[model samples]
Target: MLKNNKSDYMNWIILIGVFVLLLEVLFFNRGVIFSLFISAGMIYLGRKKSAKKKGKILFWGGIVFLCASVFNMMTFKFFLLAILLHFFIKYTSSKKNPNRVSPVLVEPEITKQEETVVVSKPLLDNTIFGQQKTPTGVYEWDDVNIQAGIGDTVIDLSYTVFPKGETVIFIRNIIGNIHILVPYDIEVSVHHSVIAGTTTMLDFHQPKIFNKAFHLKTPGYDHAEQKVKIFTSLVVGNLEVGRI
Candidate 1:
């Protein structure tokens, strides 16, 4: 009952606080927005003219104006008051409630039981600077997720058999090329993020891509039971997702 009452009071306090902030922003602090923009412009002009006397004046004037405008706002004053009140309450509560030893603190720690289970490793291992490729022959299928520093990754899905449901492959490389070959029958979804690279996915080709994110999916990807979802992130590299 006490906790519930406290929670209810907290909710009311939050709602009232929000209402007060809205009122301050709409009525009292209406000019703060315009003042902020003017301050920013003044700062920019000041920096551009910093080599001369006018630039320095503009910069210092903008800084002083921004500080004064921000400090004069009711919202800023309220925030400062709230922070001070919170610290005061916390300090008084700590002083009133002295720490006492409890059974939980003095109780002995229990030993945790250990059990070992064998787990198979993924086909693609993370490397710093090297080429990562799936074996040419038949290999057991495992979800591929690896992060590398500088390496080229090539995964041929044609050789391996995918299990039922969606198969996920995530690869993040700092500076490397990624190439994945998918079967024609399998529905594939590719989401790639690259800073600077060339992307070639099926028939769609991007010769030059800089700071771009691409999402491509087959037509029947939504309903397909067996589909591959590939997510690759590269800083400076090339990505190729071709149908075999």
Candidate 2:
């Protein structure tokens, strides 16, 4: 998966380089047209790769903005200001107080009849931009927390071996796509919060709502000895939970 991510990054870099070179050499006088074409191509490829509903909306919206830019229908300065304002708001909302104490987890009480073993590890605060891939084969972890700012994240647990109990995954994403692959034998549950996003879960049928929250779980999840629970918060992105 890491190798695949590197390859995808390299491909995007090459594509951008080629587009810039073409713009300088052949489309200097018609820069807007070139920009429109490239943006449209990106939108098309993105939709083809994920088929995400929110992604489609974002892409189509970009096309509309590009058209306005090309025709000078709106002030370019106002557009730039709006972009800046968006970033400002995002940055402000994500900020945390430095003096605030972090939460600590307490160990559960164990009875004499049963031995308590800690199988999961705590996940530190980590931020990822672009593409990220987890350890591929036979992966084992107690808990996972991820914050993805953009691009793609793939968590492949199909070949993993889970301990006898429950595992937890928490993910927050903005303008990104998260794909989780689990083994068919394992039970799974998902609780999702979406502010303009979408989620597709295996073996769960529910009407999708825009800018809303939903929960999904496989049958027999509550009684399954080995289970996984995923909690996700997404803003303008896609989340897919599937079996291998």
Top lDDT: which candidate number?
1
Best by TM-score: 1
Candidate 1's C-alpha runs over 4 A off are 1-116
User: Tens digit of lDDT per residue, candidate 2, span 1-244?
Assistant: 9589757856765565566545544645456655655554554445445468776675666656656655552234434555676587657856853347789998869755866887655433456556777765555564788787656778888656688899889988765667899888999999988755457898553344457888889889999999999998876567889988
TM-score of candidate 1 on Cα atoms, chains taken together: 0.55
Tens digit per residue, CA lDDT, model 1, 87-106 = 88778977999778766655
CA lDDT, candidate 1, residue 9? 57
Q: Pairs clashing in candidate 2?
A: 120-142
lDDT of each: 0.84, 0.69
lDDT of 2 at 4: 100
User: Against the correct fold, how does model 2 do in TM-score?
Assistant: 0.50
